[model samples]
Target: MLNLVELPDPEPGDGQVLVEIDRVGVNYADTHQAENSYLSPSSLPLVPGGEVVGRTPDGRRVVALLNGGGGYAERAVADLPVAVDVPDGVDDTTALSFIVQGSTAWLLLRRSTHLEAGESVVVHAAAGGVGSIAVQLAKAWGAGRVIATASSAEKRALALELGADVAIDSRAEDMKGALIEANGGKRVDIVLDMTGGTVTDQSVASLAPFGRLGFYGMASRELPQAIGPGSLLAHSTTVAGMWLPHVFSLPGNVFSQAMGELFELAAAGTVRAVDGGVYGLSEARAAHEALRSRGTTGKLTLDPSR
Candidate 1:
């Protein structure tokens, strides 16, 4: 169904570039789009992908973010400012996953919360795409303790292997208690939450004084509930909503510098690609089903050549 219709080749107007896509990262957003539950609805029969790793017409490897949904097919057009040169030794699969998930993790740890060495962070959904990258990035940023939450034993184990100091079964355990115990009885300095609903309350409660809670996704399928009146005042906690596109929209060289740092981390192996599955572009429906089932542990991608 994904390739039933072909999209016309996009032209680069002004400061834009047209890329022949190689691999497209399949994110939770793609699943949401496929189900028609995404934050922003796309036009019907729209191609469904946000980021792609491909080559320029001249064959320079690059990674670009698409404005419209056009990454599941052959080619896409992207703004030059948001596009970055893929580092040497980074393949298409790794580049596709790194553009969105890896950059978000880097911005959240290094820029958003200013996470410092010896501080602690708790990342929800630690086995998924963004979660897995966030786990390793937190450690690379010198976090003293990294606590991760997952629903299954296998995922919890994966989180530990990826650099988490502790992994708790969020579905069956007291998340707040486990986090506190993991941090030596002190509240964590930051909470990276993609899961919303009741998990927001737990994350708020888990923050230390002056701690920042970074919210990026709603994987729980519910809006974040309001915090109690006294809770915010008592804890002096701050909630930050992060959108990677917005981060890249800044003026000057902000976006370029950030992407450069993230690419460096990936090249050095401090941050690893979490692509757990790869599917042909025509199997997009199956990919969305797998993502919605919540059984997949890491990032998913589509190889257009297939």
Candidate 2:
């Protein structure tokens, strides 16, 4: 049912910019919104995308996070605060990756887990947009040993290339045992659990004493089982949850600080934006399917000009 339609150009209100979008970052949340399963209910007749790279009316190229969801089109409106200049060395697609996936990776380590140098960590869906960046950022931030999980060998290889110390098949029957073995017979300090459901509980069980489990997205669409407080207390482990929408809704300079750190890393090449696939704007349905299929690696993007 995806259709391209003609609409009037959006006018920029105060503190808003009319951006001519060149590329848009395809995200799992977009699929959630489309299916009406997103935690934050998007209004009806919504244009389904949140991040894009575009030029403002005055001709400044920028990466923008569209709070109102219009990133699927050739033009969209962006708030001034969330819009930042794309670095000279970065392309539109890479820059578009930074606004959501990049910052999410940064926040998982920097804010939620407070991961320290030499701490062993596990990242699920390690070849994905956020997980790919997370793998790089974990190394850059001094993680001692990073273990990643992906469905395919190619994706696992990509995770290793991105800086994961070890990569394991996520569908392994003995996932917890595999993670333990990967950490050298010891449990990991942190688990960045993106694929909720059963994985969340397993991640909690795989934690070392005083470990932290940082749960974010539930791309698996499986109902997450609850973690028993007694079990966590026995191991002195903590389970922390983060939703990007909640992070973005916070007041003060939190969003800017997190994004600034990620952008700096991207500019310096300490972290790279992994490119998975690209599709024309008119092929948005295909883009969403690609995102959900788990058949692609890196960041998926949409080119309006294509």
Q: Count the backbone clashes (under 3 Å) in each candidate.
A: 0, 0
Name the lDDT of candidate 2: 0.87
List per-prediction Cα lDDT, in the order shown.
0.82, 0.87
**lDDT per residue, candidate 1, 45-140, as tens digits?**
788888988888888788998886777878888888777898888877677767788778777877678898988999888998888989998898
What 10-residue stretch in candidate 2 is worst by lDDT? 244-253
Worst 10 residues of 1 by lDDT: 1-10
lDDT over C-alpha atoms for residue 206 of model 1: 82
- Local lDDT at 251 for model 2: 74
| Tens-digit lDDT track of model 2 for 57-98 | 899999988885889999999999888888687887678777
Q: What RMSD does model 2 have?
A: 1.3
Among these predictions, the greatest lDDT belongs to 2
The TM-score of candidate 1 is 0.93
Q: Which residue pairs show collisions in model 2? A: none
